[model samples]
Target: MTAKLTDAPVRVMIVDDHEVVRRGIVTVIDASPSLSVVGEASTVDEALRRLPAVRPEVLIVDLQLPDGTGIDVMRRARELEPLQKMLVLTSFDDDSALRESRAVGASGMLLKSSRSRDIVVAIERVAEGLTVWPARAPEEDDELSATDQRIVELIGDGCTNKEIADELGIAEKTVKNRITAILHALGLQRRTQVAAREAARRRAGWK
Candidate 1:
């Protein structure tokens, strides 16, 4: 299902350290009647203090703050108001930041250089409970032996250890051992992370 803004105008809060960026976002939001700026905070401490009074519907936040990271702000906000929607605006697009933001329940993410219209759209979408991220495809290739490649493919396909064993005519314990070895070789802590990395690689057009 798609998310939608409330019947009343969506109340928004800006959380960024940069004065110019904050002003720009405020200008874009204030220009629209469907959205309104309720408060602006340049630090985590400031945001925490203003949140209850502002009770914003959406938070447009940068990853970096003078006092703390956006992830920290999101976490604290969730504690204060679990239903508040969060949209991450950041210059950094590293995998760690992406994973961390999603883990902390950010609804959407946009590059800092995104057009004003796009930023507004992201805020609305996030307020509606939609995830906004760049499209990515699954990765199929890795620097592994043919057997390891087969194992990874099966894992990506969601095959259980016993199912993989059955498919390959091997013992379940052997399949488990093989999976452990593959994880070690790839230096990955989790199968899901490995799968995501592989998918990102494919999305980047790498072999």
Candidate 2:
């Protein structure tokens, strides 16, 4: 059975580059009597233009947009309507994207692989001002090696490889090599990015 929405019909806006995903989400949301898809946008520009007229209660957004990141759209929407609820629906589970989304005021995060019912539930939860994180297995302490953990900690402290090497009594070249390996393992690009992600992870109680 479909879950009943709140007393009033929940207005929703879908922002995704893929037409198929947009249609699928619209269908799922429209299936319920108390939820409606008021607008759909394929790009940040389109979303900005349409949102004013749609005036949705919740926005389901994808991270990778053709024009720009979905975070930009979320930021604009919040500026346009401070009370709007935003839920990030993206394939990117990277810590950087998650942190940026939260920093820009997304109410919840949902993986695209989530079931349609779960997506609907996420929308409702965010609409009610509750945050939801995609379920994941707990990480073991041993997941990262000692060297990797040290590098991560240093990165979180905003230390460059040269500084970390000087502090850790290691060769700067060795520090660089270790940092490269750590970035590859974490699927990250830069030290600052890692630092920001670490801050978000800490805030979210991931570690």
Candidate 3:
């Protein structure tokens, strides 16, 4: 479902190199009473040049642009409007893209294959100052090593380090080290958050 409409619609800009994708996003945003597309750009240079004038409250940017990476645009956008909400809409789902997008101050990230309703909802959440991301990639778990992935699965199973080590036939110290590495890789501060995230992913039908 799309977000509830407020008194003033959130102004948004669409920046994608593909015309079809940009138009599709525009259609989605325009259908929502709470969101409005104020501008569109097919390249980083164009987005940067028009950003000041358009001054959208939220920016839906594709990570790949004709002239430069979306990170470049994000850096420039921050310089122009430090508080402006930016949501990354992209086809790339690599960890580097995900991590870099957040590191450069994106409020959210959504894959291109996400449902239109999900996209709209994510934009609304981002416009309202919430961070948005998928529970997990629907495909392979490429970011984590197989051992680390098993550890995440074990954490989800409510296993303690010693129990997990025993189950996996590894030392408890190695288990602790792998757990710490998993937390760092996912940018999470606690084991509980990692467990929660994995649970969410499982609920979302991730194998």
Clashes of each: 1, 0, 0
Local accuracy of candidate 1 as per-residue lDDT tens digits, 1-207: 124534777889999999998898899998877788999999989988998889888987889998889988899988888777888889866777877987888866778887888777767666655556543333313335677678777776777888889998999987776665555445465878766765665577665
Best by TM-score: 3
Q: Comparing 2 and 3 by TM-score, which wins?
A: 3
Clashing pairs in 2: none
TM-score of predicted structure 1: 0.64
Model 2 lDDT at residue 50: 98
Question: What ranking emerges by TM-score with the best candidate at the front?
Answer: 3, 1, 2
Which residue window of length 10 is worst by lDDT in model 2? 134-143
Query: Candidate 1: which stretches are off by over 4 Å?
Result: 1-6, 139-207
Per-residue error at 155 for model 1, in Å?
26
Give the Cα lDDT of each candidate: 0.76, 0.79, 0.82
- By TM-score, is 1 or 2 better? 1
Shift in Å, residue 38, candidate 3: 0.1
Per-residue alpha-carbon lDDT of model 3 for 1-207, expressed as tens digits? 133366788899989999988898899889999889999999998999999999898888899887898899888998988887898988867778878988989977878887889788778767765666544543435656799899999999999999999999999998887776566456576999988988999998777
Give the clashing pairs for model 1: 139-199
Count of backbone collisions in candidate 3: 0
Residue-level lDDT of model 2, residues 1-207, one tens digit each, is 123355877889999999988898899999977688999999999999999999888998999999998999999998988777899988767778877987888876878787888778778767755556543333522344687677777887888888899888999988876665455445466777668866776787886
In model 1, which range of ten residues has the least summed lDDT? 134-143
